[model samples]
Target: MITIEGVDAGYGRLQILFSVSMKARSGEITAILGPNGSGKSTLLKTIFGQTSVYNGSIKLDGVELSGRPPHEIARLGIAYLPQINNLFTDLTVRENLLMSGYMLSEEERRKRTEEVFQLFPFLRNMLHRKAASLSGGERQMLSIGMALMRRPKVIMLDEPTANLSPKMVNTVLDVVRRLRDDHGFTVLLAEQSVVKALRLSDHAVLLVGGRVLFEGDPSELLNNKELGRMYLGLGGG
Candidate 1:
């Protein structure tokens, strides 16, 4: 399990997260839900070591990861996919996957690439196509495929579905679910589509102004009429 305890982090001198604490249990999807500017992305960045932590601890299993650099953290089986700039737009689909697995041996890289291709079969046909030429959904898939190349134990995604079509959104969500069900990856994602995210996630954390308002089963947030409508903008089902 990935544990965050009393984590205070931000960029430069600007603090965004305040004593934040949460747990992303193994083999489950932990959805980070919040409004705009609520520090949702910053929390993910902190976990990935993109932002500095002023206090507290971040651990994977029993290993402390707070002061470690991003690459070091990634080597510890944690992979982070930022909301944008996650893909090498100028590179071919296959090249992007190869770049992500540079640390592996040549045979291992080839083997992992084939494994990710199995997860995203459409990418198999687009191996030679430049990433910039793909549609929004296709680009998202390629970005995820790159992360999967690492064979990470925990996958963190910042808005895997931001501006895709409804069909593409479902496709992305399905892939997220399969990553856990089929591959046994621990998934943590900051999502904008609250209703869809809640439905897909095993647990949810509601953040407002950098503080956690709720953390438990997604249904608790969805079932709370006042909190849902006021904070989450969720309507009655």
Candidate 2:
């Protein structure tokens, strides 16, 4: 559903992604796995129009997204969730969700909220609570739920498991998998958690120094300890 070719992006004169090319199929989870500062996040930001792309093309369902603004790209069915500072901590959970549906009608907003509530049932009880008081897991759930308000065809998540408990991480991964399997949402997840990301993904891309080192089925990385260690920065099986 999405295709990127020779994409390069960075701040000012410092380029972070180097001729990075990749693709995400519809209704499948495609993971971008790499160590810190490998430009995985920049690739996502470029696709979402958060970062400037000096060169190459990012096509979503055959339309070029390179020069489009973020909102315009969003209207084209792309949703991005960055790693940190994802939610409004002072607002109530319901209010935060309402913000995502600003473009929808009142009835549509309520219906979408109900749909999101089904994904994170924990929010159903805490609708009135301020986001600041919610646990890390709950905050992540809120962030994801907000993104889903528009029912995007493509979703990009950056380091979703960062700073979360193991149990919460599992819960979040389960939701990601369910989105692909049950809802036909295309997923592009950039994560530092190699093992878990690979386990949940239908395909994986390994990046090092802003370059794609490997792109293939997840089992290829999982079954080969040496390749995982060398390319993914893992030391052992």
Q: Estimate each model's TM-score.
A: 0.98, 0.96
Of candidate 1, the 10-residue stretch with the lowest lDDT total is 228-237
* Each candidate's clash count: 0, 0
Instruction: Give residue 133's lDDT in candidate 1 (0 to 100).
Output: 100
RMSD of each: 0.9, 1.2
Residue pairs in collision within model 2: none
The per-residue C-alpha lDDT of model 2 at residue 142 equals: 94
Q: Using lDDT as the measure, which candidate wins?
A: 1
lDDT of each: 0.93, 0.89
Tell me the deviation in Å of residue 123 in model 2: 0.7
Stretches of candidate 2 off by over 4 Å are: 231-235
